[model samples]
Target: MVAKNQTVVTEFLLLGFGDLHDLKFLLFAFLLIIYVMALTGNALVIVLVMIGQNLRSPMYFFLSQLSLSEFLFTSNILPGMLWLTLAGGGKISIIRCFSQFYLLAVCTVTQCLLLTIMSFDRYVAICKPLHYTIIMTFGLQLQIVTLCWSTGFILSIVLFGFLYRLEFCGPDTINHFYCDIGPVLELSCSDISSTKLVTSMLSTPLVVCPFVLITATYISIFNTILKISSSIRRQKAFSTCSSHLTVVCLYFGSLASIYIFSPKIGSNTKKNLSLIYILVTPIFNPLIYSLRNQDIRGAITKYIHLIGTWQLP
Candidate 1:
């Protein structure tokens, strides 16, 4: 299986923020701090959801899953990014690159499904409160979570198959930090029209379908809230959804900014946008939920007191 005109590329030079000659260390420090905060914030959400008896509802359960996905999503790319920043750009093996690519795809798809599911949970809680418990049982939530992760893994393999067939010949330099699809595809010597077409077809539905569903779900939710006679009840209903709505706005807004709206923007601009969804959003999840929802903040206070009591003589 020899391509006569192609030279197989075994590795790629990641030109990660290399222009920042004096600011490399600063970049590394910034990334490290973000990584730590993202990890801690998401991890705290998971722990709180697990131990807080009051958080046994479907909403919190789905939120814990979302936190786990965000945790994995950032961990997949940030470590490599940090190293590349510190080293002022470095070589990444093709196999390692592909591995990162696969995981990134999986996390992206999983998060999409999880957010959509969270919206549905909110819709049920707000629109059909009486039947919410029966509809969203513990077993049902577990099954849905399993399905989301499985679908993400299976779909990532499909995309990975497309990447596997490409022939990387020359120009083995990736202009960004991690193995992003656009940069990797740019290096391929193969005819990539079919690949691009398939990728667009695949990604469009994943991003758009869930987004449409969430938007429609919220429309119904808000309508239901508006019809409620008591102002206090309407306020409470809106409060439950505000955090998820804020998260959805931030997530999809940043994603559209980079991938959809600003395709013509410079590479550096794209990288900066990548940080918004990848690092900033994940770290802010715990803060958003905790500040908006009294349940998580109470859980944190209780957990801290428990730890303090245990440490006493």
Candidate 2:
């Protein structure tokens, strides 16, 4: 039974950080710094991977992809959030909301799939050191990366197709910094059983299944590392896995906290978790990789010296 006065919502008011009226500028400034660091750091990784001959391995290839995905992921969400923070709050058209949601979902799923592939790469490298080159050939790596990206885009379109069909008839406020599936669905007037089902189906394959695979891969990697006869080799193996493990923990931990357990938590808590998931993780990725990786650090140093020599004249 539809109300006679009910009408489709043309726009949604994003709550953003409106409650922090006194601290909006401070918040904006802080996030602005984070945004710049994230972009610069990820961009540096991409450039290093592209130009450094020593970084032409499968590991650095996947790292470059991860950095590129992080760039797009942050870009899609942060600029709009920064604007909202500067303005205190703002209305976004329904189309724009859906577009932002679609891009975010695509990048998120792509990153998950890419991370799984990288874990497999690590597994092959550590567990089968003799055959690493044969197994992780450039052709195979290309196929896997293409599959990850294509599947992510396809799944995103399917989810968006279903979501776009939902009706929003009043109460057109989104209680978050950006348009996420949960917040957007909360405002839908139409029945959401189908949407929920689709989300569950996609989420399991995109997040949970990949997470399990990554865990198993790391387990195999650790088992192999334990069998190494040399202590130095063992330390080297641990160093290689540590950075990826840190990122995995942060990425999946924040995601599960927000999407899985957030129902029992407060909105403020959820918002903060979203900030970590969306903002902080990307910024920390390059720092973790560069600081922990001798290869990356060496490449950066070499490039810096080259630039310094060029500028000396």
Best by lDDT: 2
**Model 1, span 1-313: residue lDDT tens:** 3377777888999998876887888888999999999999999999989989999999999999989988998899999999988788999988889899899889888988999999999999999999998999999999999999999999999888898888887889988889978888888888888888887887888888999999999999999999999999999999999999999989888877766655689888888898787788888888899899999989999989988889545
Residue 293 accuracy (lDDT) in model 2: 99
TM-score of each: 0.96, 0.97
Candidate 2 lDDT? 0.90
Q: lDDT tens string, model 2, 180-285?
A: 8988888898899999899978876667888999999998999899999999999999999899999998998888887778779987788889999988889989
Write down the lDDT of every candidate, Cα atoms only. Answer: 0.89, 0.90
lDDT of 1 at 259: 63
By summed lDDT, which 10 consecutive residues of candidate 1 come out lowest?
A: 254-263
